[model samples]
Each structure stands twice: as structure tokens, then as C-alpha cells.
Target chain A: MAEPTPSLAPARPPTGPRVWNNPRARAIIYQVLVLGGVIGAAAYLIDNTLTNLAERSIRSGFSFIWHEAGFAISEALIDYQPNHSYVRAFIAGLLNTLKVGLLGIVLVTILGIIIGIARLSTNWLVARLASVYVETFRNVPLLLQLYLWYSLLTEMLPGGRDALSLFTAFYLNKSGLMYPVPVYDGIHPFMIVAFLIGCVGAYAWGRYATRRHEATGVPTPRFWPSVGFVLGLPLVVWLIGGAPTAIDVPQMERFRFVGGWHVSIEFIALLLGLVVYTGAFVAETVRAGILSVSRGQTEAALSLGLRRGLVLRLVLLPQALRVIMPPLTSQYLNLMKNSSLAVAIGYPDLVAVANTTLNQTGQAIEAIAVIMAVYLTISLAISGFMNWYNKRVALVER
Target chain B: MINLAERRAASGPVIQMAGVNKWYGEFHVLKNINLEVRSGERVVVCGPSGSGKSTMIRCINRLEEHQKGRIVVDGIELIADLKQIDAVRREIGMVFQHFNLFPHMTVLENLTLAPMWVRNTPRKEAEDAAMAYLERVKIPEQAHKFPGQLSGGQQQRVAIARSLCMKPKIMLFDEPTSALDPEMIKEVLDVMIELAQGGMTMICVTHEMGFARTVADSMVFMDGGEIVEKAPPTEFFKNPKSERTKLFLSQILH
Candidate 1:
């Protein structure tokens, strides 16, 4: 068989210039054009703002940051006076913000997890109650909730003289909560040290028990013994220190209570608002995350003879966390930013303090820039940590 | 390889189901099913789709709660109490059609998890036994790789090894080879056949009739939420007693 005679095709047409036809070259040109446009626009805006400031004789710089802040802040986490510089005032505001933000994060997480699991409870009443809480809190606007709490605390509570008393040491009224604080004593430091040692000892015992269980195939009781090491050791130290009992309790002095530690109503209202609002969203996130795991995984774990708690810890949580981390990070960031609404209720958070500074110094651009930068930095840090955690818990799929 | 007399003399029935009935919402999934599995006997359950065969076996380990009747395994009854269910599950190992291996863990970790946590076995001992099971399944080298990295056949075998690592007294296979490719079915079935030869009591739900004829002491045909016919493999295939079983056999065997 003679292989059919070879056939030739017609010659190809010439192509256009490579620069315009090439995808990579075109992409580079488009990126350069966009960058140039952005830089030009930014330069123009900067020059225009500076010229306008000069024309109006407005002093524009960060020099105002060094000058003394003359206004009084309602709440300060750190030592602050009207004579303090703007830098110190801002530091106090930042500290206050951090206090509420950290506390709110912890409280909301615990509340959210409880509500999320409760929503999945077998009891109809528990699930219905959880659903009601989530719906009621998340549907109302956060600012409105803050206002509601502020009004409730200020208008409904009795005067400080008629404050509601708990054991005669803790008092609650329009002035917020007043409680007893332990007086500084030499033995206090020893007790704290003993507690720290007790914590470390309990942790060590847990580790040793796990090691023993692995080595011998015999499990040991962990809960009660660890509790003993943690609480018993501290009690022993307290007894050795002669058990000093000096406390500074708040007492009514004319119109207001004096002594002890007092939390302002503004701070309480803001914290309650942030926690209650963010908790509802966090609960939904948790519920969705747990539901994302297939039912087959749970059945498989149960078939392996693992009890309910062990199955949740060993199989369910590890899988659910991968789905939970990203959205949970968003909720944390939201809570932190939502705390800025503290200004509406007159709480001294970062944005509230910066607003005061801007009004006093007439440096709108600088004050706003500082506020934006602070929020951006904290938000990035939270997301970075969550990303690392998510990576650790993620599945190894091909 | 027939050691029927020796196995029959080993012990009484290890699994007993009397008047077992189950429902899903208003749908009756299992209806008054009664069965007994003796020690060291291999029984294969075959059925058409939606026949409740899987649900029947699932109730053996209390994965699916039976609305009525009693299922006693290894002397403990399956009940609403978690303790009894856990006790029953410890003695029974089940293989799923989808091979539900923990995807986050490697093959070795998957095999060792139940033994170490549930049985309270030491980590080293559990790992040693896991490796041995992996060797038996002929995938010792794949122990370090995750389930997602393995082929369907290899993953199924790893799952079998995971079950065997616990040294369960009774093994339940629920459509073990149904999800596998035609070329890979024989690999899993070969391991199961070897397990049968070692005189393990097994209840497998599979459509692989050749495997049933080779290893099963009895063949059970279920249809419409009930066991329509059950007999020895030779008699069940050669002479089916019920019309449903005959129709199912004719359709499936072809």
C-alpha cells in the first residue's frame, strides 16, 4: 500500500505588531496607565488642600498633638487631667477603647457559642428562646440599642443615695456600678504568686496525666485533681498569710457614693450595646459553621464508639473551626469598630476623643487620619491571626 | 476452606434482632425485621435501592434508632441510653459506602483514633496495631498520606483497616463496593474474602453476588422494607422462594 501522496496547505498570513497583540504587554500598559492616573489625582488633591489651607490661614500639622488638651473626658482608663497633652489624652482614649473592645470580644464569644448551641438544642423552649434572642438583638440598629441602654441606665435607675444594694458592698444606680475593692496589702502579692504557681502546677499535672495515659493505656481522673491543685494551693497560701480582710467599700456620702471602684454609666452602656449586638451575628456565624459539616462525619465518629462530647471535640469542632474562623474575624472587627458609637452616648473611645481634639484644634484631616489608621491597624492584626488559625485547622485535600 | 462445624461450635448468636421496626418521620423504613447472626458466620444482605437494608444494619449499632423492638449485640441491648449504645458500637465495626474517613487525618491517624480514644489504648500500641492492619490491607506505605490523596479503592481499603484496628468482634459492610469503580471492586472484596477465611463474623450489604457465593454462609434478599427471602447462597440463587427476590435476582444478576 502506497501511503497517499503528501498534501501541502496554503501559506499563512502575516501577524500584526507583537506589542499590541501580546496579552502580557497590553496588561502592563493598562496597569501603568491606571497607576499614573491614581498618582496624578492624589498629587492634585494634596496641592489643592495645601493651597486652600494657606489661603485661609488655617494652621495644618501634627503640631497640635503636642499641645495641652483643655477639655475634660468623662472616662479615662489611664491617669489624665485637663492639663495633659493631646498625646496623653489620646493614649487614655486608646486605652479605654482597648478595655471595652477586649472585654466585649470575650463576652460576646461566650454568649454567641451558648446561643448557637442552644439554637440546636433538642428542647423546643430552649431553641425558641435562642432564636428569639438572636432575632431581637440583631434586627434592631446598634446605635438605637446603645441609646436605649443609656436611657435605661440614666432615667430608670434610682439616685445614688437610693442605689440598689447587693450584700451592701456592691451598689447600682444612675452613677453606674459601685463595688468594694481589696485594699493593697503585702500579702496580696504572695497570694497572687501562689495562684500563678497553682495554675502552672495544674497545667503540668494535666500534661503528665495525658502522658501517663498514652504510656500505660490507662486513663486517670483529671477534673477534680486539677481543681484541687488550682484552688487548694491558693487557699493554703491565703491561710499562711494570716487571711487579711481589709476592703474599701463604697459608702453613701450625701448625694453620691464615695470610695471603692466605680464604672461610669456611659462605659457600661457602650459595652452592653456592643456585646449584645455583635453576639447575635456571631451566633449565626457559629450555627452556619457547625451546620456546614456533613452529617456523615458525626455518624462516623459516633460509630467509632466516641461519646457525644468526645465526638464534638475530636471531630466536629476541628471541622467547624475551618468554616467559623473567617466570618468570626469579621464579627470581631465589626465589634471593635462599632465601639466608636460610644461617642453618641458620650463614652471616651478613640473616635470620640479624636472628635474633641479636632474641634479644639481645627485639624480635621490629621485627627481623622489618626482615627482611620488606628482602626485599620487593629483590623489587619485580627484578620492576620484568624488566617493563621484557619490555615492550621484546614483539611489536607488534594 | 469450609470450617462450618468448627465455627458453629464457637458460641451462640452474637447479634439478635426481634420484631425491630423503624420509621423516618411518617415513613416506615424498616418493618418488623427479625434476624439472628451467630458467631463466625458471614451473612450477605442484598436488595434493590431504597429497600432499608442499610437502615437495618445501621440499627445494629444504634446509628438509626428503631422505633420498636429490641436489638441486642454482644449481650447489651440497643436503647435510648447512650451507655448501652456505646457498648454495642464498640463491638461492631461498620464500613460505609462513601468511606467516611476523617479527611483532616492521615490514614494512620484515622485507624488509631478509635482505639486510642475509645478503648483507651496507649498511642504506641494503637499505632502498632494500626500499622499491622494497614499491612494486612496491603497499604502499609500509604499510612502517612491523607484519605483525599488516595484513590477510591485505596481509601476503602484504608477504611477497612481503620475498622479492623479496633479488633471488632462483628464487622458490618454497608455497600462497601457500591461506590467503587468496576476495576477497583475486586481489591476491596479480596480483603473481605480474606477476612471471612479468618473466621470473622461479618454482615455485609453488597450487590457483588460472586463475593456472596464465595464467602457468605447465607444470602438475605430484602425488598420494600422487609426481608423477602433468605437461604444458603446455593439455594437462594438457584431456587428463590419469593417473586420479589426472583425479580431482583434476575435484574441484578444480568
Candidate 2:
């Protein structure tokens, strides 16, 4: 009675070219009309701009990229002398744009994960704190948050020589926070190479260890190996004349602090605005994903004699991630694109740099074209990576 | 319904219930019920819908948690604490009418999952035990395929095999053939009949009178959440003791 005569024969998979000549030809027609409209509008705008410039006896071209950028950037990635060409200034501003974008993404992901888990906590206080964090940040506009953070930070920091001091020479001020910058010679580059090698080696070993644990139920040794490479290699490099080459503590003693790495108020404002606002939305998405998994699944995992942490890590999270990831990827993409709001704070991201370049050169077409291409490329790359990851974790059988 | 187990009789008692009562917000489902089943005994429970027959069976494993009752299966009593209920559930295998097999897992994995996870059985040993059970249920070849690929009859057989892999002292059938098509029902019954002949203790809730006649040593009739009558199958059918039981018998038997 108990014997199960299961079918070994796999059903033939469905096959076909399932699109394009289909009944949804209206979609194609609609897309064509939209494309036509965009092209028509762009041409009209371009014609109007050139006609106006000619009437005003102004030349329309990119000869301005070679002209000096007279304005001083409040904060810049590469050293930008006022004597540098506008094109060079644009490049520096573009790098700063990415710096804020990258830093914001990292902070939001880490904070989002922590807050998301906290929202699911059984402890009343932990869940409440997470709820408060999400609600407070999400209800406010991102631009307002940027203004608030920038203003509050500047107001708290000391002006001139009264900069707030930490441990030794690090100084916090209205202009920027000044942290130690390593002063070094040629050997410093080798130490950096060693540090990079150590990081890569440690990560590769960690991945290998994870695979071994999964395959054989034995955790591969990781701590000693990681420490030896990440810490020991750098130490050895330092002993070989890299120590003085790599080490330089920041020193501050006067009205204008000197000898340190500085972060501009604009950069801080932009990064803070993006992270707190985006992180709030991310928290809600994660909470929804966790709640979507049925309570019965948790009970079943417990009944299977799995430990509490193992139940969450293996049984609950695997299912929750399947539900969470598609939407989470979209949020991350939204955050990256939304960083263009850096212009509102006078932070010269691609948009701001391109705007100034267009004003000086009267080359509206070229400047806007560059802006569109850069944003489009960034958006497409994010989408492609997300799609790949989605396929990896998605449920195989419905 | 009532039965005394310790007469030191021919077959040993595998399950016993006494003074069982269940109420859900003022509606009593099972009322003052008592029963015991000897080893290898096959008891058929017949009742109209909403008769608490399911509730009574569910109480044996503390699934429904009877409001006031004492149910001891394979010697472990269902108590307020969960450990007692979990312990009782391990020894009492159950097959639902819906089959309730894990659809995501392969047939063999479904059979092995509980043993490997709950019983702490090694993977190899669990798979071996699962394979043996799959063979007993006549579905070893389908072990690698998901439950979705199997026909209704095959899934039921897999469900039966999954329970057997637990090696319970007794098996409970909660209308196992009710959800099957006419042709498929016969296959599941044939498997159950085979189990009954092999001396497995069983309590089946069913509308299949032919099966009841063939396998049930005794029969119990429940109505309106109460057991109204019970007797040995031959006597119970030919000369039932209650007017309500006679009416239930005629409606189902005819």
C-alpha cells in the first residue's frame, strides 16, 4: 500500500519563438509614436537653441572645454586648479559624483539589512526602534534631509582653529572633517599592492571554505588564514621601508588646518541625503518579504529539530529572498539614479558639470547627449547584473 | 465510544482514549468519547460531515488539542506541554485525504525528510530507509521526480510510504481515498488492505463500505460530533444497536 510508482519520465519542455508577430502589435505602434514624439521634440529644441544663439551673435560649439574653469569647486575628487580646462573640471566633478553614489549604496545596504532584520525581531523594543527609524526617514523628502544634515553638521562643527579634536590631530569643522592622510614615498605603492593582494587572497579563501562546508559538513579553517594574509602581509611590507613610506598622521595646529584628507560639506550632504531616504524604503521592502513567508513554514522547520538561527538562515531566509530580491534590485537602481539630486546641494555631479559646460560652450546638444549616455549606461549595467542574480535565486519549479 | 485496553487480551492495545471532550467557542465537537485499539486491529469510522471524526483522530496526536481529554498512543500521553505531543506524533503516522506531501521535494526526499531532520538519521541511512519504503509502496522508480509529476493515485501511495518511513506503531487514515477519483480510490484501498493484512494497527475514517467490510475488524459511527454506535463489522452491519446507527448504515450501505 505504501509503494509509490513515481513517473521517471520528465515532461518535454515547452519550446518556441513566442513573441513579435503576436496580437500585441498595438504596443509596437505605440512605442513608435513615442519615439517619434521624442525625436521631434529634441529636434525642435535644438533648432530653437541654435537660432537664438546665432541671433545673439554667439558661437555654438565645444571650444569652451579648452577654456579655463574660473569657478572654484567647493569639493573635488582630482586636484582641480582654477587654471585647468573646463573638461578637466568636469572629469573631477564626475568622479565626485561616483564617489558619493558608491559610498551611499554601501551605507544603505548595510543599514537596510540591519534595520530589516530588526523589524522582524520578537523583542518589542528592537522592532519599535526599527519602525521608528523607517518612519522618520521615509516620511521626509530626500532634499530636505540633505539640507538638514549639512546644516546641522556645519552648525555643530567649530569655525577656524576651534575645530573639534579627536585623540591627536583629526579636526572636524564647518568646512569639512579633516582625517589623517598617509604621507609616503615610492615604497608606499608596493605596500598598497600587498594590502590589495591580502584582501583578494582572504576573500578567495573564504569562498573556498564556504564551499567545503556545504559539500562535506566540515567548516574549512578561515580565521588564521585570513589574518595571516590580510594583516601579516601588510605588516611584512611595512617592515621593509614601507612603514615610514605608508604612515603619516594628520596634524592640525592653526586657523586653517593642514596635512590631512578632507571631505567637503557638499559631498557629505549628498551622501547623507541619498542613504537615509533610500534606506527607509529598503527597510519596508525587506519587512514585506519576511512577512510574506507563511508562519507554518517556521513551525515546520522548528519541528524538524533545527536550531533557531539555522531555521532562519536556511529555511525562512531562502524562501524570503526569493520574494524580496526583484524589488530590492529596483530600489538600489532607483537610489543610484536619484543621486543626480546632488545638483540641488551645489555638488557638481555629471548633471551639474554638464550644465556649466553647456552654458560656457553654447553646445547644449553635446553636453546633454553626454549626460544622457552616461546615465543610460549606468542604468543598463545595474539592470543586467540584477537580472543575472534573479535567475540564480529564483524558484526553479512553480 | 469506549474501550478497555488492559484485559491482557490476544492483540495488544496501540492507542487508548478516555473522557475526551472538545469544544470550540461553545460548540462541543467530540463529547465524552472513549476508545482503545488492539495491535493489528483495523477500525472504520463512519459519519456524516461535521461529525468531529476528524477532530477525534487529530486529538490522538494533539493536533486539535482536545479541551478536556486523555489520549495515550503507544504509551505517551498528550499533555499541555508540546514535547509530549511531539513524542506522541512520532509514533502515530498519519495520511490525510489531501495527501499533504511536500510538493517541492522529490518523492524519495519527501519520504526521507522527517527521518533525516527529526530523527537525526544520517543522510545515507535515511535514503536507504526511504528507498525501502518506496519499494514497499511500489513507487521506487519515481523517487527522483517531484510530487507534481505523479498522478493522484501515485501521490497517495507516496503519502502512505512517507508515513511508513517513520516506522510508527500505528497508522491513522483520515479519509485517505476520499479525494481520489473512482479508479484511483481502488489503488489506494488496495495498498491499505495490504497494510491491514500485514498486521499494522489502523483507524480509518471512510465512506467506502466495501473496504470497511473487507478490512475493518470493528466499526464506529459518529454523528453531530458524537460517537453514536460501534460494533464488530459483521454484527455492526447486520444488526446495528441504535436507530441513528441503522439510518446511517442504510444511507451509506445502500
Best by lDDT: 1
- Candidate 1's residue-wise lDDT over A124-228, tens digit each? 999999999999999999999999999998999998699999999999999789989988877888888888898899899989998998888777667888898
lDDT per residue as tens, model 1, B88-196? 8888888999999998888888998899888999989999999999999999999899899999999999989988887899999999999999999999999999999
| Per-residue C-alpha lDDT of model 2 across residues A1-398, encoded as one tens digit per residue | 78898879896786764666565876887899999999999999989988888898776666777888776666777889878888888788778777887787789888888899899899999999999999999999887888888788778777877778887657777777778866756666777899899999999999997666544445467889998889887788878863674545556655477787888777777787898899988888888888987764554444333445655765567667777888888887888888888888787788888887777676777788777887788778877888898788765442
Clashing pairs in 1: none
- lDDT for model 1, please: 0.91
lDDT of all predictions: 0.91, 0.79
Residue lDDT tens for model 2, B1-254: 12323322655578888889999999989999989888778899998989999889878766578878688887777788767666777777888877866555678777766776557566677788889888887889999998788989999999899888778778888889988989899889999998988778889999999999998889999998888888989999999998989898788776
> Residue A305 error for model 2, in Å?
4.0
List native contact recovery per candidate, as a fraction of 1: 0.69, 0.05
Docking class of 2: incorrect
TM-score of each: 0.95, 0.69
